[model samples]
Target: MDTGTLALLIPIMALSIPLFRIWTKHQKEIAEMEVAKTAERAAQYAASNKELEDRVAVLERIVTDRGYDIATQIEALRDTREVEGLTARSESGIN
Candidate 1:
C-alpha cells in the first residue's frame, strides 16, 4: 500500500515475467524432444514386429502344408542312407 513497498514490488514483478517465460519455453522444448524420441522408438518396434510376423507366417505355412510330412519322411530316409554309408565305409576301412 505504501509507495516504498509498491516501488520495490513493481521492479521484482517486471523481472520475474521474462524469467517465467524462459522457464516455460525450456520445458516445452524438452517435452517436444521427448515426444520425438518416443515416436522413433515406436517406429523401430513396429518394424521389428512386422519382421517377426513375416517369419511366423512362413513357419506357419511350412507346418500346415500337406507336403511337409512327405518332405520330412524323405529327409529321414536320406539321413538313414548317409548313416549306413558311413558305417559301411568305416567297416571297410575306406577312409
Candidate 2:
C-alpha cells in the first residue's frame, strides 16, 4: 500500500522467484539420478537372470544324456538275460 512497503515487497518477491527456480532444478536433478540408478539395477537383474537360464540349459543337457545312457544299459541287460535263458534251454534239450 505505501511506497516503501511496495518497494520492499517487490525485491523480496523477485528474489523468491529465483530461489524457487533453483530448488525445483535441484529436485529435478535428484529425480533424474534416481531414475538412472533404478535402470542400472534393472540391467543387473536381467543379466543375472540370463546367466541362470544358461546354467539351467546346461544342466538339462547333462541330465538328458545321463538318462539316455541309463536306458541303453538297461536294454542291454535285458537282452543278455534272454540270450542266457535260450542257451540253457537248448543245451538241456528243452523246448
Task: Per model, state how many residue pairs clash.
Answer: 0, 0
The number of the candidate with the highest TM-score is 1
lDDT of 2 by residue, 1-95 (tens): 99999999999999999999999999999999999999999999999999999999998987787876877888999999999999999999997
Candidate lDDT scores, in order, read: 0.95, 0.95
Q: How does model 1 fare in lDDT?
A: 0.95
Candidate 1, residues 55-93, lDDT tens digits: the string is 999888877886569688889999999999999999999
For each of the candidates, the C-alpha root-mean-square deviation to the true structure, in angstroms, is 3.4, 10.7
For model 2, the superposed segments whose C-alpha errors exceed 4 Å read 1-7, 68-95
